[model samples]
Target: MSEKIYVPISPPTLLESDPRANLSDVERALYEEVLKHFSDSEYQIPGIEEKGRLTEAEKFWLSYECLLRYLRAVKWKSAAAAITRLESTLKWRREYGIEDIVSASHVEPEAVTGKQVLFGYDTRGRPALYLFPSRQNTDEPTRQIQMTVWMLERTIDLMGPGIETLALLINYGDKAGNPSLGVARTVLNILQDHYPERLGAALILNVPFLLNAFYKLINPFIDPVSREKMKFNPEPVKDGLFTGDMLMSEWWGGDQNFEYIHEKYWPALVGSCEARRASWLEKWRALGGKVGLKEWEYKDIDTPQVVDTKAADAKAVVDSEKISDVLTTESRVPTLAAA
Candidate 1:
């Protein structure tokens, strides 16, 4: 049969009248602490237009704290198991596209821009990664770039520092066209700055137009001092053309000359990604390091009441509204009584 999937979430929402009623005293303390942290400064989220707001990094960290506790307590093991499964599904999708991939699994399919959206459990069995088939307009670089940043932050929250070696499978298709150099630079900057060790491993298929654009855009941005070592130079490259082609040329009617650089080339391109992440981290630190993000880190924040399984179905169930009120309450954290 198919593997069982579980989505991780914090305590259910409570009504305004019964917010603290459902939470244990200790749990309430934790929540307060986390909320207080967010009241500080944050960067502007790309898609979110609110000015003078907490940065996405800060929000992500807070969410991560809650997510870590929830996943560690119940779903960590299963989430790890799902990674292997994700690889398998991704491989199958690469071979046959979305229709065949979805048919092979138990996930329900949704349509986004006339393409299939395959939702599945991530390393933590949470509603983690949402895979989408290539589509027009929607999957363009603008959207993809935004999504990439958002996902990276979430990845850091879920897996923590070690997730630096994570690999992503990008479906390049004939649909939305290629992303621009600005997008690539933005993505690279985020990785190099925040998640220093995390290097992205991507498979660009279908749309070759982006290859030249990305190359040109990135070539000049290479660190001047490290230009010779860090730069990627191709032979007589052109804009909007996919020249190097997919690494798996055999599958696409080539003489297999495009083997993985790490696998077959002298550079050793194909292997565990841990080293790449490490290299990125080292280089990023060498480049003067990142600024402080005080708003993002959850220090001494109030914890939420973890509604365990038994409590989920208790006789006197609390309403979601009440839970929401507690979550939204701006009241100063009242001191705990001496016990």
Candidate 2:
């Protein structure tokens, strides 16, 4: 059988999964309190006031999953601790201008060499992000790090109800594209602080002696949990992490000939993610709009609800109106909810 494939979302693997799952009664109560806190507060960004008015994207950002991720980061220990980290990330996002400059065009140059390709998925349907440091095209650390952050954000966009993490494939060929220790630390800090639990695995390949030494230098910066996720010289296909067609071809791999032509791959990836987000936003809006909404509701929202037009026509309510015409399934896209 083929391993599970994913694009943005490939439907939730489980019905009773999170935004908040595996919580004790107390932890569940704490989640509710955190929700209340988010609801009652107004988070102000640099140029935008996220108080009474919230755009779709803003609403999307302050989503139920986003909060739960932070709480999970702190191991559901203290609501205050989770809140502190959450607030810090919000501040960093403002300073980092997540809404303003982190876009396809802004990070386009860094991606031209196809150094970091966001392609494929693990067996759990988590998006696979492959890094080829040898192809690093820019010397500017800021843009480079921005590109990293941008990719991380893109992976989040690609996650689904039961899927909240990404598979990181690092191919440090000749260690040429390896970043400085300072840059590595900054990236690691950002991942642990802002992203927490979002890294499903970091499959490292082609570890030269220098690269192994380099990992030692930055090992302390990596949290124990993340370090646990890292595996050197992984055999993904053999281990069943990925199936043949889905893994990156020619390397660290199964059989996907994932050639990264920036012009083609970049636009497709961004556009597809945008479409997935729009689909999710539309579904969320139909249910009275919520930063309060649970992620699993997507599964609930997609439950089959067929309308009987014949029965409607027999009733006295607008008898002549063609409800069937407006409610046909002819134009519906094949959504993950159906899977």
Candidate 3:
């Protein structure tokens, strides 16, 4: 009998030794393709105006953002996997010039890892808001604030006529002593008083003030051509609505120009969510919240009566033909005998 060989399992740690440990072959190939396209000499920041002078702290944070963006796109499985790819990806690593920083060396894992994302898509399956920003000014902090407002407005719209939800996302980076903050607080107070029947959940994402400078520096790399393509020129929904070809075309067109760093990898995740929506909704209702279809809410309501003038005209023409012979004794006797 041959001796059995035992494989050793690695212990969990904050740092991983190998950079390629996290990468699947396909993912590694995709990473290389993306970097090859984006890392050309033309992509370099030319001057201080486009890419501002970076301090040591700013350099560290920007590199962290870049690594997380790539890892997030890949959907890594574990902490070790996430860190390993973060170190090996030359596109991001070259910017920072170092590998993963152990959480223990800096701060506790809970401090950074425990923080939740600020705003998520709501229960109604619509985004809370559409953050449409002017291409002229592309500040990340500003864009984040705009997205926050969009989320709040969308929530209120979905909640129905009289109901409201209390929510706000503030960027503390903007004008520290500004009076607008007080105005925002007052508005929320008024809304809370108006919608006493519903529970309000407030979400706040407080990004560090250093982010203002970060966006300013990275503006040159923001892909201007893509932004131009994404501009919305509204058309009547009735023109091309619900055409399968149109939907797929629009999806494909938008996909080629720009990629949302956070949302690109969510389609597969959402497919799983769709599979579980029915059960998840039932569990949500069991927790004491109301669950009913939008159509159900309007069941008793009557739609406006529609009279077709052409149909009425056709009926009048048939009546004028005077078909009384069909109802006469001769026609009726023959019809009855055949029956």
Candidate 4:
């Protein structure tokens, strides 16, 4: 008898009526406190106002949502702690030329390896990012880090209304070669320090003993909150917080075979990224370079209640192509999530 195949199901729309509707009381308080702190002249970043790059008002509006992210990362523990974290990230971004990283003309060569892909959104509407460690191509640490950052920015652009976090799925199957431990540490630091409170869940699937041992070695370095969000090799359908149908057959232990073709996948994926970049540029121009002002004002214009139909249509096409490619190859592409 043939094995049973699970079909993915769409989850109900979970977008909040008000973006702040989901914030806890403590979170709301911290949000206001952090906003006020930044708005105060004494606490302003030195040289920001002197340089006239941004007025005090623009700076406060721009840093609004980002401050909340840091606050939530620390569980609203301390305003000082959140500001410290945010300031560090801001400095890093300035030095790293983050704006250039996001607007680069071409995707990095390392990114085309199909190692990491933004598959789809999870049931909770958070973007789902998949990492196939086996597909890692470059030994250059800088390239690895850059590729990670680029993909992260891409994933952030996919965030919709009421979606502030992302689901991470790391597949450690058919081991290629050992990944650089130092590189891994740097990547983790970036996530924990700069992108705090952005992880919804991290699922590690098909872990080999050696990798599991490495995970144990590094477990101590991970924060308690992040460590708690990790789940390993559980029944995806029952315990993984994702339906089997939403995942690839190989990783989810389902029956729908799929395979990933880099050539076919890259064009569609890159096109989607380009479209989003264009839309973002248009909005930035319209806002006169004040990107996060509305969001900071606790206004609805910052977050759209409905996902962009054009973007959604493009994603659906990519999904259809992915399914078709898998069916043609008689193997599934190791998907990490379903919409």
The prediction achieving the highest lDDT against the true structure is 2
Task: Supply the global lDDT for candidate 2.
Answer: 0.67
The TM-score-based order of candidates, best leading, equals 2, 4, 1, 3
lDDT of 3: 0.27
lDDT of 2 by residue, 134-202 (tens): 898788998999999998887776665556788899887755645799899999889988888788888
Global lDDT of model 4: 0.59
lDDT comparison, 1 vs 3, better candidate: 1
User: How do the predictions measure up, each by TM-score?
Assistant: 0.30, 0.80, 0.20, 0.71
**TM-score, structure 2 vs. true:** 0.80
Q: Regarding TM-score, does 2 or 3 come out ahead?
A: 2
Error of 4 at 37 (Å): 4.7
The true-versus-predicted C-alpha distance at residue 98 of model 3, in Å, is: 54
Candidate ordering by lDDT (highest first): 2, 4, 1, 3
Off by over 4 Å in 4: 1-30, 36-64, 102-107, 253-258, 277-339
Candidate 4, 1-339: lDDT as tens digits? 234322121222334233443677777777777667665545545434444243433353244466667776776788888877776776666556566654434345776667887654544556668889899877777867877887887676556545677889888887745576787788888888888877878888888888878888777778889898898876554553543334556675543443455655554455555564455445545555442344323322332344433443233212222222221221221231211
Per-residue lDDT tens digits for candidate 3, residues 1-339, read: 222111101110111122333567766555554444333434432233444333332232222223334444346444445434433433332342222332122222211221111122222111122221211132233332333333332233232211222222122322333223333344333233222212322222233445345434543443343223221222212222111111111222110121222222122222222333333334434443221122112211123222232442233111111211111122233321221
Each prediction's total of clashing residue pairs, residues at least 3 apart in sequence or on different chains, is 33, 1, 1, 8
The number of clashing residue pairs in model 3 is 1
Q: State residue 168's C-alpha deviation in candidate 1, in Å.
A: 1.8
Q: What is the C-alpha RMSD of each candidate to the true structure, in Å?
A: 22.5, 11.2, 27.8, 8.0
